[model samples]
Target: MLEALGLSTVNESVYRAMLTHPALDVAGLAAHLDLDPAQVHAALDVLADLALVRLDDTDGTARAVRPQTGLAALLAKVEADIAVRQQQIEAVRAAIADIAVTHEQHEVVLRLEGIDAVRDRLAELARTATTECLSFSPGGAQPADTLHAEAPLNAAALDRGVRIRNVYQDSFRNDPATLAHARRMATLGSESRTVPTLPMRLIIVDRSIALTPIDPREPRLGALELRSPGLVAGLLALFDQVWQQGSPFGEVPGARAGELTPQERALLQLFADGHTDESAARQLGISARSVQRLMNALTERLQASSRFQAGVEASRRGWI
Candidate 1:
């Protein structure tokens, strides 16, 4: 009944038994619930992780925490996670506002109708970019066709000393083709990193010309090319901030003990912010089934019996 709160059926049953049969020992609770001793111990481990139950230091008996106390702390952490998405929204809104004002002035923004046109423009900019090229590549993995077409352009840019820097989604780590491409790009002097999410798919050349999709959520529609200094600068700053938070390409992030990958941590934050599996999957660019798979893996890795326990332990470890 309390499963929505991250509790499993066994966990809820165990917790309720503990509250009602306050004097019951481990064996007693197991007998009362018709569960084996092993199952009872497992549930207690999860309960302890959630701070829903504590081991009495002197007597070594398990005691249930009042729901008001334990659940409130979890709720407070959930509230704090609200800022993550808020920051992203405000950044995108500011960029849109800057683009709107410049777009009205005429001659600052150009509409590109198709992928071919966008590529032609990119080729032009790539050839002329004298200082540096910056881009935010969203979506999980690069399409094979797109990457094939882009490789030569990147090579040409590198050959001329136009520094190439890119920010890709953290999910790219799970794709072998993408990781291999990143490695090849790195050897050719490309500087790239991965962040959990990016506000838009953007490309800025020499910090002067910027190309951003008209609608980030549906980039296949088309894009807007902007040359206004104000608009470009805002987009550049956004890249800089996201880049600062990114893990450099080729590095294994959050591989250490008690840590979560940036993407994994971002998923947890969204879950805390009240997103369902489907909603979190949408934000994380994965299937809802994948979200469940990830949480199950996390639960096992943390030696937890339930998602609630894993999440709580992650918080205690400062992972979220």
Candidate 2:
């Protein structure tokens, strides 16, 4: 253990022998320890240099200093050495900070590959968001597990007083899971709206950083993170335009007595846009059978003989 304080094993042995037999000379210590006199003399020299042992020249005798004093001095020296190293580490960190900032500024666009990477980056952004968060959920009905995973992040942001504004595809209205998720978020003070179609999936935090899928059709591949001011501004503008056209998730606008409900109007628009029943159902977050039933109801209400006639009658009434 004394070796840790810079004492060699032989030096420690000699010092211990002196403490036990303060009158012993080097030759006596060597005989007691079964070491050569030359070896004992070398150990004595080291102990003397460390101030762990003292020699009386007139008497030619050696004795150990008090262990408390010797060990306390060693500890103080070790602490001083640690303090010097800490100062060096601080200097190095300060020198690297500017370089790190410069590199980050130069790298404006970052491409993150793989679903896990994208999700992790998004989670990090969400966790760090300060003022606000804007998001666009374009696809129809999202999986329940996906919404479940995202709920806590949204909840945490809301808890921090981060204003959250989300735009979801109109089809989400027909999805039970999505509706429940939206309701939960609304209760937590998040604002949400719905549009018939959305351009792409996006997330913007504090208008300073944005994330969008690299390919809207293949979101699982990866996403692009944008930090450039101009690019983020453009994306924010697009979001605002869509946000203006969307209706609040649970709001019901007043209509004339004979006017179509919002769902009916959306159905007519989807049909006029040439979307197939299957596609419409997917986009509306409903089953294909539900689409057929809605179509039948529309034809009956319009007093039309066919689906084409129903579209014509609906358009004539300004329902499309």
Candidate 3:
């Protein structure tokens, strides 16, 4: 413990020995500690510099001071030194803060490599968010474990009154875990919506910074952290366009028999626009099998013998 205050092991041993035998000289201390006289003398020099020992002029001998007095003085000096170093650290941090901002502004876009880096940046952004957090999670049902891991951070942002808006693919409605997560988020003041398709995974914090996958097909490879005003504005505009088209989670408008759900309407619209089944599945964040099943169900419900006939019936029913 005393080593942290600049005392060596030998110095500490010698000091302890002095406390036990207050009248011991350097030679006596060496014999007691099984050390050479030179080593004991070196320890005595350090202890004396630290005011732990003093020379008695009348006897020309070294004496240990009361530990309470000597140790207290040493502690006071250490604390003062620590305070000065802390001030220096704070000064350096303040000096770097502006430089960091300037560097980010100049770079405009930073490539975050590796999953850990991406997650760390996301956490940092969430922790510092003050006004709003907008996210687009495009894909099928989100994993329960992933949602569980993010719950605390999301809840913390909500507690700070940070408005959170999330957009997920319509297929997430079929996922029990995602549905439960959405309900929990809603209780924490987060708003969610679902659309047939989303451009990419994205996060925008307070409209000042944005994060998006560099390549949506290989999202795990890396991500881009964007701060350029123009790029951020463009992303924000795209998000707004999609948000306007999304149906609120768990609150889709009621539909009668033969009436299409929002997701079905979107599928039909994509099909009408000449999107292939595979392309539709990719856009809708579902399997081609699911798309085929939805189409088959639509055909049966419309009493159509073919996809074309189903589309005609759907159009006639204002379901498309």
Best lDDT among the predictions, by candidate number: 3
What lDDT score is found at residue 247 in candidate 1?
A: 90
- For model 3, what is the error of residue 50's alpha carbon versus the real structure, in angstroms, after optimal superposition? 93
**Could you list the CA RMSD of all candidates, in the order they appear?**
5.9, 33.4, 30.2
Q: What TM-score would each prediction reach against the true structure? A: 0.68, 0.60, 0.63
Candidate structures ordered by lDDT, highest first:
3, 1, 2
The order of the candidates by TM-score, greatest first, is 1, 3, 2
lDDT string for model 2 (95-156, tens) is 45643564378776788897789888878988999999999997667777668778999999
Higher-TM-score candidate among 1 and 2? 1
Which has the greatest TM-score?
1
Backbone clashes (count) for model 3 = 0
Worst 10 residues of 1 by lDDT: 72-81
Q: Which should have the higher TM-score, number 1 or number 3?
A: 1
Positional deviation of 65 in candidate 2, in angstroms?
99
Tell me which residue pairs clash in candidate 2: none
- Candidate 2's C-alpha runs over 4 A off are 1-106, 252-255
Tell me the lDDT of candidate 2.
0.79
